[model samples]
Target chain A: MSDDIRKKVFEIIAEQAVLEVSEIAPEHSPQDLGLDSLALVESIFAIEEAFGIEVPFNANAPQQGDFDISSIAAIAAAVERLVAEQRGA
Target chain B: MRRVVITGAGTINPLGHSVSETLAAMRAGRSAIGPLEIRDAGRLSVRIGAQVRDYVAEEHFSRQQLGLYDRFTQFALLAAAEALAQSGLPFPDGRTERAGVVLGTAGGGVGTWDESYRAVYEEGRNRVHPFVVPRLMNNAAAGHVSMRWNLKGPSFSVATACASSNHAMGLAAQMIRAGQAEVMLAGGSEAMLCFGGIKAWEGLRVMSRQACRPFSADRDGMVQGEGAAVFVFEEYEHARTRGAEILAEVAGFAMTSDAADIVMPSREGAARALAGALADAGLAPEQIGYINAHGTGTAANDRTECAAVADVFGAHAGRLMISSTKSMHGHLIGGTGAVELLACIMALREGVIAPTVGYRAPDPECPLDVVPNTAREARVEAVLSNAFAFGGFNAVLALRRA
Candidate 1:
């Protein structure tokens, strides 16, 4: 189930970043993947739509947000946790 | 070229129902933003707004007029009436062919659209109101104002998203200055607190559930507000001949488009408008004593506005006092600039500068003196009011003390 969520996240990010799924590595930063503000927002929206969940975005402090984007892996990990919490709820 | 001056002003906003009341609220450091009292509040992620509370439409308008008039139009007519009464215009003699109106409204009858859409889509109804088209048209308020005042010259509405009112007022002043009109009633009104309107803005993700603290480091985002403000911008000689009390001299105005991003603001574009207005007025940067900043509380806007001010004003930037009344009134979007002009008049005419009430922490990016949390008695010789819209429209107006 965790791998499925990670794969979905990577696919969504690849589509938003205008890159192939294979080009997206777990360690790459969003900037390294060439994602601008609009692209990043679109990726978040796609993830929310796919998981049927809401993501909390903060101003001036991305680390404090519910979804961490230090790297692609961090985002996947956060999404996995949020999806798990949603299922439990 | 003739000089343009403001002779009359009226408003019905979150701060107050009249200019005196609104100025009084600003003097006491009052913020009217609170929990938004509207339908479907439970479904909305953000519910706090600066709404005009305790207003009953029936008390102000007849039932027949309400049928044709949207909430935005109603607010405009009320404000226009007050302003005309103050200006003593359309005098006992008669209306002039050189008189007209130019009002701004982003969503003219947004409330009517929201209600009709709900009736047809959500409630599964087919037929809607027959007057929906006229009510929802963007120029409805402007048309009604012109007809009511018997203004026969150039009259129209401007819709540049957030900078609508500033553009309208600037154009009106330009018309008067060019000798095309002698008297033009200008300003803006907005009543977009309906569910559809809020929901549409929510998609932009630039709203804050908390307070709007512009120029503050920890500020999150902008809070929405609603209402209208109208002013009579007349030729200086015309106003003087008619024995009208001049509120402030509309010294100079300039507008520019970024032509860049759809949502993001450009610093160079904003700086151009500021500098252009000063050059138009032939006033040096040192002459501007106060500025009502387009401080929308968003991180990008505050930083960019400060940078623009710094770019245009140079060393004088540090000396000038700047504040965002949005902290108290919320972001009215289209109607914001017109309502904010009142702050400029108050600062120039009354020597009272309204404070940015929600400011807590200082932002290094915005190092200018932001009159924070309390009103100050400072005699300002000249002032500038700024409005930078989402679509990269920048409008700046310079006003001198009357």
Candidate 2:
């Protein structure tokens, strides 16, 4: 995982959650970070748009999907993998 | 207070273009959801919608009419014509003064708005069509239905998102009950299957790409549908004097607001509306045999609605036959409740319960009998229709067998 990717994802999530970047921690879950459904969805969209890769996630089946949204660090790692795969393809 | 009864019903929906056609499709448990045929379908992640197929505007309207009628208005007009014909009401006559039109739509002329925006932003057009305002107005459908039939009493449109139709019909029934009007053409219509409509919903990320499977454990989200359903809601005595065919009685109606989160549903608010409707109809929980659920196939809605039904009906909720016709026709958004009302009518009049098609697995959270995947024959004296909108607006209508 790249720090650049993690930092960018944190920035997007922080913006949607209306919190400072420094206030967020990689171990914090979306719920723990206090992201509502709308905010969570916006964070995903912003992350996708920033990374130029589709994040395969459904709000209803968030737990079933391959994208690990269990924590902020997990989401960033998934985004790193998606970016690498999309660029390689 | 006057009694309200449905003397006629008409619909041009994904299931069919007529009442008989719709009932037959519902009986057969057919699904109309399919691939999108609109412009920029490839651009959308969610490409499926329950669209009114084989629709040709030129066959139904003239060139001048097409210029003024958006897709939503066209569906409303067609359904209204069929309903009025079935009702056998000669408009612009002596009785016309006591008749009115009240219809509903979530996004009025969404396609027109999309086209106009594209013309200005994408194509760089300096100006749009002169009739664009009239074509896309929210009241365009109701206004046209009123003018076309010369309904002079009261005519307007309601836009409470998904609950628009139920609210419109409920208000129409209230008007007749209060002696404000003897007859009303009440229902709803929506044509938001275009590029703009789906694109906007796509942003919300609440749409499913494949199907709308309400109550199914694997259900992802709702699929959008398009069409209109209109009915002739006439005073009982007025209908009887004319020897009109009575479909069902609009026995009770109740509405409530959650005042909670705009998107998330409140179980207490939904339960209050359900209990209120049953109480208004002077019927106990056990008297109600069927409920056309506001099951949008979303996890949040199905779970909350089931919880509400369970809370309202108690042990009787398990005995009640509740189904979501949206599984077959998809969520029509504003016009959905009107189309779902037809299912309630079928339950009361024909002893047929429409199935919630596309059910694969059951979710434990939704423990009630969902009448999954297959239509059933059941005799019921009364049934209820539920519509809860995005803004936490809840409206439920109860109907009695005629």
Candidate 2 lDDT: 0.92
TM-score of chain B of each: 0.99, 0.99
TM-score of each: 0.98, 0.98
lDDT of 1 by residue, A1-89 (tens): 89999999999999988899999899999989998666777788798899998777654345556778889999999999999888773
Per-residue accuracy of model 1 over B1-402 as CA lDDT, tens digit each: 799999999999999989999999999999999998999987888899999988999999888888889988988888888888999886323756888899988888899999999999999999998999998898999888887778888999999988999999999999999989999989999999878889887666678888999999888889999899999999999899989999999999999999999878999999999999998888899999999999999988999999999999999999999999999998888899999999999999999999998999999999999999999999999999999998899999999988
Score candidate 2 by TM-score against the native: 0.98
Q: Which regions of candidate 2 are displaced past 4 Å?
A: none
> Each model's DockQ?
0.45, 0.67
lDDT of 1: 0.91
Each model's chain A TM-score: 0.91, 0.93
Write candidate 2's Cα lDDT for A19-72 as tens digits. 999999889999998898888888889988898888877777777668999999
